[model samples]
Target chain A: MKAKILYIEDNEQNLYLVTFILEKHGYEVCAATDGQEGIDMAARILPDLILLDIQLPRMDGYAVARHLRTNPNLATVPIVAVTSYAMAGDRDKALEAGCSGYIEKPINPDTFIQQVEQSLTKQEE
Target chain B: MIACLVKACMPPNITHLMGFFISLIRSASAYPFRNLSLFVVLILLCFEVPPARAEVRTVTVGVYENAPKVFTSETGKPSGIFIDIIEHIAKSERWKLRYVSGTWSEGLDRLAKGEIDLMPDVAYTADREKIFLFHKIPVLTVWSQVYARKGSRIQSILDLNGKRVAALDKTIQLETFTRLTNSFGLKIILVPVPDYKTEFTMIASGKADAGLTNRLYGLMYARKSGLEDTPVMFDPAPFYFAAGKNVSGKLPEIIDRHLSEMKINPQSVYYAAMKRWTSEEVQFKLPLWLQMLGLGLGVALVMSLAGGLILKYQVNARTGELKLINQEMEQRIDERTQALQVTNSKLQVALENLAVAKEHAEAADRMKSAFLATMSHELRTPLNSIIGFTGILLQGLGGAINEEQAKQLKMVKNSANHLLSLISDILDISKIESGQLSVFFESFNLKDSIFKVVQSVRPLAENKGLFLSVEVADDVEEFTGDVRRVEQILLNLLSNAVKFTQKGGVRVKCQRNAGNYVTSVTDSGIGINGKDIGGLFEPFHQIDTGLSRNYEGTGLGLSISKKLVELMDGTLQVDSSPGKGSTFTFTLPNVIDSV
Candidate 1:
């Protein structure tokens, strides 16, 4: 079965690019426009992996991470935080709030899929 | 026996005794001790029995048994201390002397009654002066002191606190002892004796536990009276001879005359008598051997100590000069060292502050890099899709783009690549400023790197319709340096050459000079003015502010290229003639090999 991924991103272009690429790689993708929608969709879908965007409207990625961690249904879902704001300590912040993996944006079309797979593998281990 | 005398002599506190008797009668069982005390008081009131008087003379003198001063001596002659003093006065004045012995109180009574002409050894008090004429000067010094029988337990004044303590009647000691015991809250029996001699005798015979007498007589006549040494001495009294106030006599004048004479003339009989009685105290003649030893040791000790002190003084004076000089030099050294330490600490603080400033600058530089990266990413994220999708369309992946659409897609791709290059230049400058741009050096073909750079820049020149060429010296091919940065330098110059030139050509030439490979780029375009040439190598500066919109750039190419050349241990320079031509030149050192 194709690994389903939930991408919680506020930017439409970023979401389109990520979703199009992820779909091209044969993974079922569910997109959310904001952090709350992402958390809501994540609980319902129970996707295999979640690509949480740190810069989001209404709620940020860490908040989404903690909310996702609370739901028993999404306990096994691996969260990978994607951030475009390249400040210091952004990765540690995302990881501290229950993100199993971290990736920086603008995401490389070449390695984004492999990085997601690797984070999924890491969560499995 | 002594306790009974003690009770008898103490003028019993009649009121306290009455209270005790009342309490005793109430008890009705303690009548024995009460009757005994009553009997003792009666005996003390009536027991004293005698009266004695003397005949008259030129100066009838009354002498009390004040022992050692006016007492019956061992020979029983009419002699005592005052008698001898009077004999000296009588001899001087050609007057006959008369002396008599009596108790102190009896003598005072007789003198007051004008029976005696003068009484000696009387302590002058304000109360006594009303009855007698006291002399201004004292004849002798006396002490009221406690004396005890040989081997008796009454050895000290405190021991006589509850014992019978005898003091001469009408003496200073009597009043003193009364006040002292009252002040001390001592329930002691104080006996008023007629004289010190009898007081001493009573103590010696154990009729009294302890009695006070003149300290000198207690010491002088102690062994004779079978008593031990005086234990407590107090209230030093000055005794003066007093004349009867009732008699208007020349006695005071005569007495003062002889007393003053005796004081001035040590050879007088008074001095002889004092010397005779107090001979035991005269130890002016020490043993001969001890005197000799003391003199020898004293002289030797003083001489050696003086010699040592003089030598030490001379040595200290000699060393003090050297010490002063050394102290001055050492002070100068210490001052200089302190100044140097201050400067060193200041420099250390400056260094620490510089390190902090450097850290802050580095942080700003990092932010700039991140800014550039984000800008590059943001600028490229759109470009990524534009260029990638365009490339895809041009490749006919979008199901056959027509030739016109393909041309537009290609143009879009090229613009995006240009934008990417500009972003990279900004990133590179940020890296150099932040000290993050690392150089990798290796032995590589210098000509090949330049050739590749030229080939890559050929399209920009061709697009501008400017001819570009490369020239290389055969010996300057292989060089040890960061070949990539060298190529980047060459590319920046070549691109600038093509970008600026409108109707002319660009050329690159390489040659070897002094272990360095020099590269130069020449352009025949709208050249920079000499004034503008200096600023041309600075990032984001342009000479053509004419609004002609002629050349396009972020103006970072030359600055980035200049820094890259410097990073490879090279120099970048330019020479330009306005509106005519320009040439950019740089050199990369061929790093030497240690192996």
Candidate 2:
């Protein structure tokens, strides 16, 4: 079975690139253009992993992350933050807000799928 | 006949005797038988008549008031010791004396002019001997004695200093007192009265401090007028009977003769006269204790006066010293005040400059941080898409691509990746400079991080046909530090090694030196000159400064890596020489606290 990933990002190009990369890797990709839609869609579809962008429109990725953590159904789901907010404590901030992993932006396409798989695998543990 | 003539020129007393005898004879002729013996005796006594009686000489005497000596008595008679002696001699000589009373000076002038035959009570000096004739004998010995009002301070000759003294004018007392005081270097004011009586009057009236009078007069009259005799006495000489030079030398000789005879007799008229006049002198004596008390009081007064003078001198000296000290202290205070004011102004200027510098530095840091934030997010967001899409095209996920197209796509992906690294390096250096960069401390396997960095840089080294290698010691196992930053520093060093090496190879070695990890990256392509290596770690500095620069880089990697290592309390150093390979080593303590 194909593991599903919910990609929450405001940049359409970033969403498209990530979707294409994950779909090519034989994983089903779901899209949410904003943090709230991502959180709502994440709860409805119950995706295998959530790839969150820290800087998002409407509800921010950290708030969405914290909100998703409160729901028992989405709480066990892996939430991975893929962000360009890479200065100093951004990774710790994402983790503190209930992210399972943090990946710096301008992600290397070759390693992007591996990182997503790692978060899903972590959730499985 | 001559015998009868001589007998007829005899004295009247003898002629009167003859007259009685002749009358008796005439009476006997009338009664001859009754008076016959008396007529015979009268005729015999006529031959014994004395020669003509000596002529009675008249002497004019000058008298002045000098009591107990020669002064006019209240009975209008010339009386005193001199008068009594002169009168007795006059009686024996059968001489008539004519008294002329006047002031002492007037009498002296009368005697000088020979208008008076004699002047009494004159003190003899060699100067007076030139003008008047003095008897060989002085009638009395006298000295000038000082008299003052009762309870006056004048007690001795020296005590007459600065006093106003009254003395008789044209007298031996005034002339001799002036001489005596001149010799003693004492100054006194002389009030010359006409007589001793006036001198006593002036002193009594408080016009003079003391008076000079002969002792005979002072002793006899000083007490009568409430004047006391002072112990100051000088110029003791005999008081003589002064005669006019033109007077018969016989008169003084006769006076001298009588005085000499009278002096020896002791019971003579001279003694009788002196006793009569000076007998009024009081003979009172003070008790012994009273005299001693007066002496003690005198000594005390003298000591106190000396002490007062000494104290005044010392006070004046101390006052002068105090004034000098006060002036010096004021000057020192003024100097200290000036120095303090200068220092205060300098400190104020320094504080102001420091405040301004701090303000400028803070503002610059704020701007840098803002730029770093913008570049980190805004630039990388677009870069994420470019690198991702280009990567997708190269992989042929959409459709199969020809070799040429695939090659172009690969180039496109490489260019994008390079651009991303440039942007990332700029953001990193900016964050470090602005002090916004921070490290996270986590336990990570040291060998794992080194291998990952080596794997990522291996592809680039292979593309350049350069060998890549890594050697981490067995002891360089799991350690505590910022895992991300450690990986970043190793990747930066490895990438630099791969980029600079043309052939040969690049090597990475990690070892545990005591408690620290020493990681070194050595490259065999082109080595840097020793001089150029010094500036190699400086930001934006590259060894290639030529028009045709060979290297493609932002020249920020090594500088950023050096700064990152230093942030974790580590040191990065480079060893290289021209035409030889370069080795870059870094030492980081295994346990660094993350910020």
Candidate 3:
């Protein structure tokens, strides 16, 4: 069975590219425009993994992660943070805020799924 | 002297006196009028009556401050040893002595104007004799001396030239000083003090460099003022009583007779004055250390003890040696400083030369690295993509292609691979030229390395339909070297053998040669010329022939292989002949395993 991933990104072109590359690599991609909607989708569908964005409207990724963690069904989902900013503490902040993994953006279509699948692999183990 | 006179003139001596007068008159009668006139004048002078009863012959004595000889007494009278002599003359000649006081030069002025009848203690020179009539007998023999600060080095009259000297303004030594200056053309400045004491004081206090005065007065004052004596006589002159040049009376002849009488009697006032004034004690300027030793002792005794013998034995030798040692030390310091400067400059030049060589080597390395970097990026980028995409296409990911099309594609891939190797060879040449080539030492399977190179080159051999083979000696498997570079060297030689041999077989042989691994590649092909063999392993050199154009390459294979082998601490060589087969051989050092 194909592993499913939840992608949270505000940029439309970035969302389309990651979705296209994931679909091409035979993985299912579900996405949201910002942090709150991403949390709602993660709770409702409880996708195989959540790919979160750090900067979003009304609620940031950290607050969204808190809101998502309150839903019992989404607790074990591997939350991967996909970020465009390469600030020094961003990776540790994402992991601390309940992300299973971190990916710096301008995402390469080639290694993008391998990184996402690595997070998904952790959930199975 | 008075007793002698009384004895000569008393009645017991009356006939004797008459006898002497008759002889004097007899000589006068024989000489006629001129002799009689001189005899009458002589008799009048010789037999003058006592001034206590007869008409007084008042003689004005001109006096001045000249210390022991002619200065005024503490009682304010014109009295000194010279005055005592004159008083004796007054009592004998029945003349009343009147005293006039002034400086010594002023005494001469007063005498010249006839204001005083007698000026006592004059240093008689021909110049002074023109102004006054000096007595026939001198009262004193005198010379001038210089007194100085204890450390001053004035020992000669010549040493005083251009020096500041002290002198009494009106004294006889001032006259002597002036005469000496004019005679020797000296340019000394004389600082005139009022009395002889201060003349020596000015030198002791450092106000003047030297002082000039009578030796007797200077000696007394030099002790009082802590001054040193130079013992250099300024000049000597006979000191005499002088009479007025205008005087034309019996007074002068009377005074001369009394002086003659007084000199003959030891009991005379003249002899008493000589005993009172003459010291005969002289002192020289002792060196400072000795003078310090004489601080409380009698200066006269110290001077007598220290005059010549003791000083000569001690001072000259020590001073000469000190001066010599000082000169030697100064010369050594100057020589050492000059030598140090020369060596310092030489070291500076050496440092500069090393810096220049280092800069040249560094700049060459930078240029080589920059050229290699650009080639790696710009040239390899397109070639990599072209080769990679071609590989993907031949894998049929897009679609299938016809055999003819695939053959053309295969040719493109082969040519691309060849071009890549040619570029790599050029880059390697630059690296070696700039001394930037690096190699690693490692141990690996030597036979496996050879067989790998053989496998890679076998298809090229098959394309030419040439038999290719390898023989590795039983003991030649594991070795030590930079494995990748060694492999590259083997591949270069194998590729060249396959490319050059068209009809005959190519063979690679590897063996252990007495602890070293030697590899040789032999080929049956159009062989190199014997003359061309020398240049075969130099970069960018190829032999020209009818078949040369048919081959396409940078002609860099054997050269890069040779240099790469050398970089691995090995040697590569070629043996060939025109139209005969050739062999390329190389030897690599082995890591000897311990038992």
DockQ computed for model 1 against the true two-chain complex using alpha carbons: 0.06
Q: Model 3, A1-125: lDDT tens per residue?
A: 89878888776656766676677667888989987788778877779988777767778887777777778898888887776433325566777777778775444433566788788888899
Write down the worst ten-residue block by lDDT for model 1 chain B: B48-57
Q: Which ten residues in a row have the lowest lDDT in candidate 2 chain B?
A: B14-23
Full-model lDDT for every candidate: 0.75, 0.83, 0.75
* Ranking of models by DockQ: 2, 1, 3
Residues B1-595, model 1: lDDT tens digits: 5334544644433222332233334433446787667655644543342222111237778876765677766676656677777777665554566776778788888999988888887888899889889767678887777778877765455666678776776677778877777887777777667767777778877778777777777767776777776557788989888899966547777677668756877887778988776555422456889989999999999999999999999989979988999999999999999999999999999999999999998888778887776775577566556654555556564477778887887787778777767766776777667676767777898888888888888887888788888899998766888766787788878887887788879988998887777889999977876677768778777666662377777778888888888887789988888778789999777887322
- The better candidate by DockQ, 1 or 2, is 2
lDDT at position B84, candidate 2: 93
Q: Is candidate 1 or candidate 2 better by lDDT?
A: 2
Best by DockQ: 2
Candidate 3, chain A: TM-score? 0.92
* Separate DockQ for every predicted complex: 0.06, 0.60, 0.03
lDDT by residue (tens digit), candidate 3, B343-460: 9899889889989988987887787666674664446545644554455446453369888877887787777777677767776777677666667666899888888889988988
- CAPRI quality band, candidate 1: incorrect
| Model 1: TM-score for chain B | 0.43
Candidate 2 residue-wise lDDT, B163-247, digit = tens = 9998888777788899999999999998888877888888889999998888888888888788998888888878888899988
Better of 1 and 3 by lDDT: 1
